[model samples]
Target: MADNHLGEFLRARRAALRPDEVGMVAYGVRRVAGLRREEVAVLAGVNADYYARLEQGRERRPSAQVLDALGRALRLDADAQAHLHRLAGTAPALPLGHTTDRVSPALRRLLDGHPGSPAYVVNRTLDVLAANALAETLHSPFEELDNLARMTFLDPAGRLFYTRWNWTAQAVVGHLREAAGHDPDSPRLGELVRTLSAHSADFTRLWNTHTVRGKTQEAKHFLHPDVGPLTLTYLALDVRDSPGQQLVVYQADPTGPDAEALTLLGALTRSAAL
Candidate 1:
């Protein structure tokens, strides 16, 4: 059988949607989960047979207009809609295959410049390419800080480190799904997903959800081993020169106790090196 990612995605999303969510009365006992294929076809303004064909992988090429309609019907967000388009070969593709792990001198300098903030560079597969002292200190609890997904799912410290462990897991899986949509041919990504799936049941469950999202600005909560609770806001910026590379920076409120804790964390790292 062909590796039908598009069909799989469509099936997952369709199964996730509920009748009431789309203002349809779910009459009688339903055998299947979420909306049926015919319901989605009606909502998307497409023929039932055509939609079935699309989901069965018989039809691969979908027009932008049809995709837009389907996106609306499925209640996809901006990122997911783009991902759908990319999967259908309608949108511009992202950088394919393994991205370079090397971080530029300028980028390293930039990371170091943010002395008060914790900053790190990660690729599509959540591999940590490089990190500043603060960033390293912030994630010191992890046995292996190489990959965020591995850290989140495999590391013993992950549950203790992330205050909202479930939310972090969901986000990580969703981001991975988006990455898969971008570079379906990436061996590294495939390996990472396989490893996570084999090891972590939580990762496997979220992976099956087909949630697609990119890392944007978000509030992250952490329980630092040394400093207790720390809540920080992080921003994920794309590296223009390095495709699939994202510079993630975390900041605490300047006047808050979290900032003081961050400073203390930095001091601990510096002291350890002394």
Candidate 2:
């Protein structure tokens, strides 16, 4: 796999954009995918050789102004722009030991209070650090649901559980890629990546795409064996004072069938616990 993450990301992002998408007219029989390196250099107002050097990993430490121009030229979204800055080494790196997997007492209490919604906490490596009863019930299909990436890629039941398996897989991989960039030396993250890369070809393919994305809000589709199909919206909140931990909560429309199924599932889970 390509270890030059900055170069890899730049190449991927550049390949994802087209000339017409950026208001450039396409000539007949274009050979390259997306915009050419020279085209990007012209659009970003930099010399073509300099931009080539940037992609070749020979030139690092691009100025803020140049990064901004490149961000615009690439037509990057807010998240992608932030990722570009991080790859360019413009963003401040978090010091080692600053991140923790521990969930606070207050956060645990908050998760317990959300009986109607499925809530859980995950660290940077997507390890299930803490989870409420409903969350556990929701993910009960997986034999080992401790890590989100493992469940998404390695588990046989993942395809059955996730109605949109491809989307879920991509999201999981993208989130992990973003986390890896943030904390490259994380032992847990490295181990997980190595294990998945060895076992799962899909995981290896997605990991090489060099996509970086953080989960914020997204509609999820789950086909629970007990509850049937469910359409839920999830919100992932960054836990305060916990650098690597995220509190994710899932909910369905109050008047929908999913909501009714969730209620039944909660009751069943609570009764089973007794």
Name the best candidate (by TM-score).
Answer: 1
Query: lDDT for model 1, on a 0 to 1 scale?
Result: 0.91
**What total of clashing residue pairs does each candidate reach?**
0, 0
lDDT score for candidate 2 against the true structure: 0.87
Who wins the lDDT comparison?
A: 1
Measured over all alpha carbons after superposition, the RMSD of each candidate to the real structure, in angstroms, is 1.3, 2.2
In candidate 1 the C-alpha lDDT for residue 198 amounts to 95
Clashing pairs in 1: none
For candidate 2, the TM-score is 0.92
Query: Which pairs clash (backbone N, Cα, C closer than 3 Å) in model 2?
Result: none
